[model samples]
Target: MSLGAFFLICAMPLLSGCAGFGGNEAPPPRPIVTAPPIAVQPPPAAQQPTGVARDPSKFFTPAQMAGRPLIRVAILLPFNSPRADIRSLSNALYNAAQLALFEFNNPDILLMPKATGSAMLAQKAAQDAIREGADLILGPLFAEEVGAIAPIAHASNVPVVAFSSDTKVAGNGVYLLSFPPDEDVNRIVDFAVLRSMTKFAALYPQDDYGNRVRASFEKAVADHGSQIVTSASYPPNTEGMNLPVQRVASYGGRHGALLAKRSELKKAGDAAGLKAIENSDTLGDLGYQAIFVPEGGTRLRALAPLLPYYDVDPRKVKFLGTGLWDDPSLAREPALEGGWFPAPPPEAHAQFVERYRRVYGAEPPRIASLAYDGVSLAVALSAHAEGERFTTEALTHPDGFAGVDGIFRFLPDGRTERGLAVLEMHPTGAIVIDPAPVSFGVPPAL
Candidate 1:
């Protein structure tokens, strides 16, 4: 089948009336239909069958299953987490998964929600799901919880599409569906290199996320035959950012050069040179064409202005970032006005957000798409013959699967590679400078 046809087939079952398929021609407009919200309720206690095993059928009514062959998909989340924020996120994820289930209209698939408020609980939940004959498993949002369930899922040969971004717990039957930092780094660096940016610098936080982005950034620059002129890491706080930003900006060296230039101009008694140096605090370029600021939110706002303050002119030096810069508020930061970042194509995500709002009456968190895609993928794959469905070969298909986030495929190592677009920050909004590729191996139009 053609890529477009394959995507239309896989995506039609999940999307509302095939709304967001990729092609040159726009899909015809359809009447807006508000789907009934899936109820968010506590799962009833599981009833054990005649022997030691638990009956997964007990989790659903006969009418919902409708006498079809069962495909139990266990979704483990921290529904009872001590933290309110975690609880809310868990609920949202579950709701998204439920939305996918209804939209796909798959009667054979039974979604099982299990609480994983702690690592111990997560392990037990995995045990229960396996014992209950879960054909596939979906979540357990944190890395620690994923670790707790990986061995159990591997032992049972049950494939898990998890939501955690940590690659440490991914592999051997556990695949992460969440966005990885490497994707953002690779996409942005590839676009920057294509745009003739060779010399690079970075200012990243001195934490796990920073370390991951730094490693990816270095590898990407080297892979593209570019060089890192300078980089610095600092604590992710307002107070700890100044020194690192200044260091990356090369303030001391440039300031010393400015002083030397002023002295030379005075000795020569050149009025034009003196006047040119008068308003500038630093002299000479930072020797980098682009600088990576892989930060977001308050930290980004705090860290951005420091570059211009230390004479790293944004006009001359392009500011690059990861997906963290997807925030619209970042447009207000003059330092990021011309910055470039990689993110999922916004048009599809915007449509998804609108549908989610219409159904659930609130804005879904950005990561909520992970759950929707995971369930949609499962439903799409379930159409395969019994033995072939949910296997490594089927799940790792090179063509990948179309998702709300974009086209993504599972790597053998259990990491997901997604098609991302290069977006430029503008005062009005972020605009796509380069579109995301619709299929693997085909490059996006520049």
Candidate 2:
């Protein structure tokens, strides 16, 4: 099938079923199309523009406004960010949004791309978008940028569906669509608790992400009637990890106890006690039944093995993680095998990745799905009556919208609650052990 036709078929369910929501009820599940394989070559470097091009003509064409009522949705991003990585992310987000628009075939929705490389620039972008009669704003992908534009968008009463994971900027008409660590922590902890794991520990980094996850982890454990027996904080990098890992394992105390026991056995002439202590490095049970490791990538690799190395045996104490542990490569780490983490269901996301690769000829960043879903949401809501398309009430429907990442809905406070699945790490890859719910209303507890 043609690529355009495939997307059109995939988009029908969302466009038709997402129009109306009465009262505070869950919406019916919308069917999603799984695209077949398509052959396409990769795009060249020139196709990925690094420099900012604010030309209005690039996004808005005369043919798009063929007498239909327009819904201006402005997307503010760091198109000219000094950091090349940020700039590339901005381009990917823009491309994803454009792809969503094209797939849904929403001609009346004019996507206005604005550069927000700095707070001042983001404020100006917000002003320009509001001046251009934008009904809704999509992003300014940083916390500072979101803060800069919040008042302007609020004054204009243009609702913003931003992409920042920081919950601090997620209120007063600014909804965050990005994946917050709280959701991951809550889901995994809930799953652990359901499986009868009571006491827990954590090994986290000393950074903003770590702090956020730590807070969520504590609350989740407490709410599930479980206790946090111990936790250790380490530097964000590989350095300074040994002390913290050892601390969590109580290595010094446990080893000291082992030596003391061995000496006592020798003095008392108890051969069995001596034999038990002869080979054992530690002599005490861990206080916790499970340990939460919220680090990922290199830091995760460095941190995970230390637990087992320090005698916090994975067989005795479960290893838990947040969405940061969603990497398939982490499965190769022996310490992470049988470890569990929470993430969005992979079925629809796999299809999204395939489609994106076919079209863009590159792997879309993990967060790129946010832009596609944000645009899909705007398109779905555009089918509503004029002046009611982007209201807070309309946006916060209890029955959330289904997207490539699965089911998600915005709260009145602007925080997004997502349906996450629990996955176990195996030598081959991560496998979904618990499926994500198709609809909302399920409590986090068993």
Candidate maximizing TM-score:
1
lDDT of each: 0.82, 0.80
lDDT by residue for model 1 over 1-446, one digit each (tens)?
A: 64334655767454555455446755433323333222244335432211224465554434645667888888988886789998898878877887777767777887888888777777777877778778899998999989878877887778899999999999999999988999999999988888899999998888899999999999999998899999999997788888988899889988999999999999999999999879999988778999999999888999999999999888999999988898888888998888999999887777777667656788898888898888888887887789778999888877788888888888888998899999999999999999998878842221
Which residues of candidate 2, in runs, are more than 4 Å off?
1-66, 265-279, 442-446
Model 2, 45-117: lDDT tens digits are 2121111333333333347385666788988988767899998888888878877786677778888888877
Candidate 1's TM-score: 0.87
Measured on C-alpha atoms, candidate 2 has an lDDT of: 0.80
Predictions: Cα RMSD each? 5.5, 9.6
Which clashing pairs does model 1 show?
none
**Residue 234 CA displacement from its true place in model 1, Å:** 0.8
Candidate 1: stretches off by over 4 Å: 1-7, 12-66, 267-269, 442-446
Q: Pick the candidate with the highest lDDT.
A: 1
